[model samples]
Target: MLTLLILISVGLASAHHSGEHFEGEKVFRVSIQDEKQVHLMHVLANQVEVDFWKPDSVSQIRPESKTDFRVKAHQVDEVEHFLEEKGLTHEVLIHDLNKLVTNQFDSLIRSSGHSYEKYNSWEKIEAWTGQIAAENPKLVSRSVIGTTFEGRSLYLLKVGKAGSNKPAIFIDCGFHAREWISPAFCQWFVREAVRTYGTEIQITNILDKLDFYVLPVFNIDGYVYSWTKSRMWRKTRSTISGTSCVGTDPNRNFDAGWCEIGASSSPCAETYCGPTVESEKETKALVNFIRKNLNSIKAYVTIHSYSQLLLFPYSKNYALTKDHVELNNLAKAMVKELEALYNTKYTYGPGATTIYPAAGGSDDWAYDQGIKYSFTFELRDTGRYGFLLPESQIRPTCEETVLAIKYLSNYVLEHLY
Candidate 1:
C-alpha cells in the first residue's frame, strides 16, 4: 500500500508538469503569395487562437513573405485544413513546441555559477547587475531608471570613465518579453566592455570619449511574466480597464507615428498599442531619461531578435529621413564588420523598406528626437529557433554583435562635431 501511494503521487506530479507548458502545439511557416492570401489568413486567425511568430502582426504580412504561427493541439487539424483549402503553401517548423520549451531549460545549470550558456532568470540578472557594478566601481555604476508595473526596479548601468559632459550612446535590450537572447546580449556586452576596457584600443577610445547607457532589460514586468507564467508573453504587465488582457506591447507604445501602421488597437493583440502614446511606465521612463539628456545623447540602439537585420529610422512610413544617406552608409559598414567574425550575413536599411512598417518603435522615435545614429538590431538565426534561441548560440551571437556595435560607436564618436 505504501509503494502504490508513492507511485500515484509521482504520476500526478508528471501530469501537472505537462499541463503547465504548451503541450502538442505545432508551429507552421506559411508563404504569403499575395495580399488576398494574407487577408484570408488574418480572417482565419481571428476565428482561432493563432500566435504569430514572425512579422509579429497580421498588418505586416506581405506578398512573397513567409509567416510563422503556432496552433494549439485542438485547432491543429482545423488550421491545417483551412490553409490547405485556401491553397496556402505551408510547412511545419516545429513539430512539438513543448519539447523545445523543455530543451530551453535543460541547457542551464546555475548551481555551478553564472554561465553564458543559459538564460538567466530575473533574480539572477538582478543580482548580477549589483555584483558587476560593485566589482567595477570606476568603469560601471548601477542606478534605477524607474519601477516596472509590478514594482520591480528597472536597473540601468552607466559604463565609462568618470567624467562630466561627455557624449553618450544609449542601448536597451529585451523590449519583447520572450526574446531572452536580447537581454543575454546586453549582459554579455557589459562583460565584454569590462573585460576588454584598457586592453582593446577601440573600446578604450570609445569609453574615454563617450559614456554608454545600458539598460539590461527594458520590459522588466513582461520579462518576469515570461519566465514565471507564459514563455510566449510579449508585452508590459499593466492592467487596462474594461479588458481582460494584462499588458500592452511596449514597443508599440512609443509616440513615433502613434499606432498609425503595423499596430493593433485591440487590447488582446500581441502588438496592442496601449490606450495612449507612452502609456507604459517603462516606455515613459526611458523617454523621460532620454529627453533629460537629449543634448548629450548622440545615438540610441534597441536590440531585438530572430530576423538578422540592422534597421534605421522611419519604420512608421516609407519616407526617408534627412540623414538617410549617411545612416545607410554607416549601417552598411557596420554590417560588413559584423559579418567578419562568423561569416554571418545581416541585411541593413530603413525599417519599413527593410522588413515591415512598425509604428511607434523606440528607434524611430529616438531618431525623430534628433538622434541621427538611432538604430535597431534584429539578431541571430532568421527563423529556425525564433524566440526560443538555444543557449548554445548565445556566446557566438554576442561576440559577433560586439564588433558591429563597436564599429558604429567608433563612427559616431568620430562624426560628433
Candidate 2:
C-alpha cells in the first residue's frame, strides 16, 4: 500500500515520466473457421503473452470469425511458428505498434492547446474540462463526480442548456486506458454540442429538452499510466494487495454479472475484475452517480473504440434483453446513421452476440438498473490500426460518431414514455 501510494504521488507530481514505449510489437489478425482453430488460438494466447484486441479474451474467440491481437517482438517468432504448426490463417494488421504510436500524430507540427483532431494528455484534458465549463457556463458546466484511487478528481461535464428535472443521458468515454479514441470522441461530442447548440436544429432541440452528462475519461489513473508507463496499459492504476500488478479493469469492476465470464479473476490478466464489485474507486464513483440519478437518467451511452459497433445489453450471457426488439431497431437506425457519413459500416446487436460476452460491463449494469436505452459505441477502424488509431482519422471518426449519437439521443427523447 505504501509503495503504491508513493508511486501514485510520483505519477501525479511529475510533469512527465520517461515513457515505457511500445517498440517492436505486431498486431496479428487471425481468421478462425472452426472450433479447432478457435481452441488453437486460445491455446496460443495462453502459451504466450499477447494483447487481445477484437474479442477481448481467449474465451470470446468464436469460430468463423477474425480476431486481432498484439504480440511482443521477442515472442513474434514463437507465435509465428505456433500459428504455422496449427495452420491458422493470419495477417499482420500492424507491423510495429511503436511505429504506429509515433505516427499517431497526423502532423509533426505538434498539437497546441486542446484540439479536436489530436489526442490530449490527461493534464491537457483535465484542464480542458474546467476551461470549457468556465467558458460555456450556460450550455456546459463541470462537476467532480468523485476522486479516483490515485486522488485525481473525476470531472463530469453537464452539457445542455441549464435546466432541472430533465431527462439526461450519461455518456462516458475512455473506459479502457489504451483506447485513446474513446476520450477523443467525448471531447468532440462536447465541442459539437457547444458549437452547434444554436445553429444545429437537432442539437438545439435535444439541449432544450435533455441534458448530457459527459464523462471525458472514466479511468483517469489508468489513462495516465498508459501515457507514462506502458502504452498498452488497460486497467485502473490501483494495486492489488498481494500482487505486483498495479490496476484492475474498471470496465469489469462493476457489479453486472461481475467476473462471471470473459473476465479474469487473476490480478495480472487484462480483464481483471478487481477484488470485488466496485472495488476500484473509479468504478464506485460511476456506479454511485448512476444509481443516484437513475430516475432522471433515461439513457446510458458508453463510448469505446476500434470495432465500429453499437451494442445493447445482456453481455453476461446469451439471453436476449426484454427490450430486445426496440433496442435492436434503435441500434439498426443508429448504425445506418453512422454509415451515412464516409460509408463506414457498423454492426449493431446484443453485446454478447454482436461481439463477445463480457460480464461486469458498465453497459450491462446500466441496462439492468432500468436504463432501457443503454448502448455501447465501439468507434472506428475494424482493425487496420487497432488501438493506435491515427490522429488524422479522429475528425472523420468522431464526425460520423456524432450522427449515430445524435440519432440515439433523439430516439431516447421521443421514446421516453
Model 2 weakest 10-residue run by lDDT: 8-17
TM-score (C-alpha) between model 1 and the true structure:
0.94
- lDDT tens digits, residue span 232-311, model 1: 88999999799998899998999999888999998988899999999999998899999999999998999999889999
* Per-residue lDDT over 311-411 for candidate 2, one digit per residue giving the tens place of the 0 to 100 score: 99988889999999999999999999889989998998998988888899999999999999999989888998888798789999999999988998899
Off by over 4 Å in 1: 1-19, 106-113
Error of 1 at 275 (Å): 0.9
Query: What TM value does model 2 have?
Result: 0.94
Cα lDDT for residue 313, model 2?
92
- Per-model TM-score versus the true fold: 0.94, 0.94
* Candidate 1 local Cα displacement, residue 221, angstroms: 0.7
Candidate maximizing lDDT: 1
Candidate 1 positional error at 278, Å: 0.8
